[model samples]
Target: MTTHAPQTPGHPLPTGFPAGTMILTRRGLVPIEEVIAGDDVFTHQRLWRPVTAAMRTTAPTVRVHCASLASGLAATADRPFLTRVARVFLEGGEAGELSSAGWTRARDLAEGHRLASPLDFGKPVPVPDLPASLTGIDPADVLRTAGNMIRLKGEAAAALRPELVDWLAAQFGGYGARRRFPAWALTMPEELRTAFLDGLVNDGPQRDQFAVRMHSKSFMVGLRLLVCSLGFAGGLSSQGRPGKPGWLLSWKREGGRRPDHDGFRWHPVTRVEHGPEAEVFSLSVAEDESYIADGIAVRNRTERLTSL
Candidate 1:
């Protein structure tokens, strides 16, 4: 003779989603149920947190449809979603505007509530000066080294010109060298950065829909990082077939107004529907107790008791 426990708003219910939900991770978008402990997921703060635990359970769930996310977000009713509540103005001598935001339970969410989405990508960093050692190098030598790196020859090689080709070779290593870009790559000036990328695209495989392929895995990784820092969506993949032994990097530009927070863009909720009970998955992140699923930020049930 046992009675069912009552569930209340903000109760410490387990948080998770059904099998089809996509979880954003460092590797890319992966199914939530497929994610295991020790995988790093992208958070609302634009940081990566390792999954401390992964669990599967049967529970009631809700489907939240938000702008820009076609499939919608599905999770337990008590799951906390990062939301923007309101806008407030300070009443001091100076008039300052601020946005009020916090975590709201899925059961309380409704149409028009703004959900925090991650920024498409970050902006390009500015490099103040060229490396001291490569500053005085002759343009011919730089051009020659750059051409040789990609096996370019003749008039086309001459056309593939950049002021800092030698610096690129030195910084990124010689041809076929597998090494990630150094720290200084985070602050490359626009002109020099563009020149470098253009040089590679021009000499490498034919560009198709803004995608480029390269032979070095580390080079592709570093190139993707640099491209992402320039506020473009840079996706990396490997050409892992029998004949193809290299990597591919593709990019797209998502131009829009900047979000209030550098790491998040607020997107409005379009629909919220309660769904039937089913199996779901959840993760215990190292910090923040939060992770973005299909671009929607949601809280994890890391603690036994979490208040609204």
Candidate 2:
């Protein structure tokens, strides 16, 4: 007779499988199952390769406090609304092989947690004097819109909106809702804010001037969303492992009022990729030339691209 290890309720292979596992790799936190022997895992200042390893024991399950996890998650500047538990990979000190330190829910990661730093192959990288900034745009608008889009997909995803709203409220407080403007928008220079509003309501050279400035802000915001969505989708696709290919995803904004010629509006475009293997999926959003150009640039530079 053959004997097998006891499996977790929702996972395959009972005790030994690395399902929902995350490991600190050179790229970032990747699933332990996805890790290859030569992959570089992180330590404080050194990189180590995981050659061979096995799970020896399983810890007794403990009741995790949901409120604690939620509060800890709230502190994150970019807290994801959805989450799940996964096995995390951590460095085993000076040891070369990676270890499945324990199982942790992604939402439960707290402030003091450390991740392996990515290895740069002995190159002198230039450190910029000033940090990059995404200024003058209201992130709440983007987040709210994104949340709504997810929510409208129906009950299967109904929880997303409230989660995002609660997280935003925690981060920015009631001020934004009370003022009816995004926190960042409220902080804009008086002249710039007035100009932006005027550009929305009026036309002519003055509107054009303000529109140009406002559009610059919009472009930055859109670019940020585009980049973030791509990363989020790619990461969610199991780091593009074989048989688990990743996708390049994007969103479009559509059917909104256009205030001025250069006013930010979402435009729609359809693309078909012809290849030996192809699949069709669709999503809608609005756009302008700047966003279109940026989208093109992103697609040109990426693989397996898809838009929503």
Candidate 3:
């Protein structure tokens, strides 16, 4: 959800598109069902714009829903992942369990409040007015902790596991409403691109770590921290990043793949802030060569939840 000047009113969807709305496709675009669903979560879409030959994707509002909770049905609270995360604040607990980085990031977000796509901010995006919410927040904390609660047990990340981590990474890893920019827009200076790549592969993939790849290559890999820029969001921008940020890497893969994986790939996508909810973020990916510039892999998505 790239930030729009006057955002549209988004309705709360009981769930995002029914689990199996996407029929099987020869393309690697797997059905949402392919993702594990222990949480009973589902996503449905409200389209604002349709994908066109000129553009790879349509503007749409995706509502993530879970079973409603009632005092009589308090047990249902265990269903949605976000509920569990919020429980930390509800349980009269200090967020000390959050890593120092996490703590710092959150404290920062509390200050500079902003938004991204309509999804990031919630339905009926809030209009950004001059408020303390827009000042002095570390976008890093907001990215790391929002919609996530870290339990300092055995591996800290273990609490979230494949479920929370996978979910968070998907939604927030790439793009949002505030930063209308995407992966393709990350303009790293030439020397920095190589340095960034070197730093990423430094450990040669930790079994417990996360990774962002291109041509099956590990680019920036690690527990990343991010924040949406204050007030200004992407999509509303007239051009890509102010300067080219990273080296363009082109490649080819013969087997199953995504368009973004084609001779199309970019590193360190852009991040910006826009909506009332700075959590609203956006990112763009380069298209695969075969699919042309506008391909599915190169498309953008809005994440409702994620952890830095």
Candidate 4:
């Protein structure tokens, strides 16, 4: 699996994202425009489903920002987003508690409405043998590259060694700027996944569960996808407001139990605004009509609607 940018491709009518919307696919985060029929994608069910169709659209979109959602989600107003309201008995007040979850439209979402944020772990993909080590790369070259990776010291330095760093760099460039998981690492064996996550945890404050903060948006985003891909509930939170720097990446330990609310956390909607009308994309999935987008459960439109 690898991340991709927008490109033309062939499918129908559903509320969709503009160009550059990164979708979680079997081949990693691929642009919706680039997605084609038969591409397997991760769904809210924590299972893989093949894409039945793809569609290009231009619609008026609503930009929805949740309390914990970084960058938010942009989709047509009628697009269904898995949401739930707090089970508050009081008059007109949002509470910490929640009620049964249901699908809600992006335009209908209001302040304090809770959206289902995916933290559920996924089914593991088996990898039998590990890749052979490189023979010609210089140790000094690797070390020099390591200097540009996440800073490590003491025992921590060993995890980001020349071999590992070199290997990762060669596969997924953007070492210090935009960290990404190499395709091999994304579907690595269970043992290697454990070691890889542990190494990442070592790069940050690890008092309770594994939690780390990084300034690189792409890197943190990639890490979030990596953890989620490995069947672990991963959460990415921006330290400041949108467009601001810094992101906190946290996840349950590999062997730990699943997250509460069936591996989903309630993300309160913070804002909803009228966004510009732009080109969007949508996909039709086989059986499960819903797919995970930016950590939230979003369903594609079964029937097309007129412009909002």
The number of the candidate with the highest TM-score is: 4
How do the residues 229-303 of candidate 2 rate in per-residue lDDT, one tens digit apiece? 221111011113454432222221222121111111111111111112111111111121000111111001011
CA-only RMSD, every prediction: 11.6, 22.8, 22.9, 7.6
Model 4 ranges off by over 4 Å: 1-13, 87-97, 127-129, 133-160, 170-173, 176-178, 181-198, 201-219, 225-259, 303-308
What TM-score do all the candidates reach, one by one? 0.50, 0.20, 0.17, 0.67
Runs of candidate 1 with Cα error greater than 4 angstroms are 1-13, 86-98, 120-260, 302-308
Residue range with the least summed lDDT across 10 consecutive positions in model 2: 295-304
lDDT of 3 by residue, 115-233 (tens): 11111111221211222442464433332332232212224543633334543344324222111112211222323323333333333223222223221101110011011111111
Candidate 1 global CA lDDT score: 0.58
What residue pairs clash in candidate 4, if any at all?
Answer: 2-27, 11-54, 121-231, 122-231
Candidate lDDT values, in order: 0.58, 0.24, 0.20, 0.61
- What candidate 3 gets wrong by more than 4 Å, as runs, is 1-135, 147-208, 211-308
What local lDDT does model 1 show for residue 265? 51
Q: Order the numbered candidates by lDDT, best leading.
A: 4, 1, 2, 3
Q: Comparing candidate 1 with candidate 4, which one achieves the higher TM-score?
A: 4
Worst 10 residues of 3 by lDDT: 68-77
For candidate 1, write residues 57-113 as lDDT tens digits: 679999887544434667898888998743332222121242467888888987546
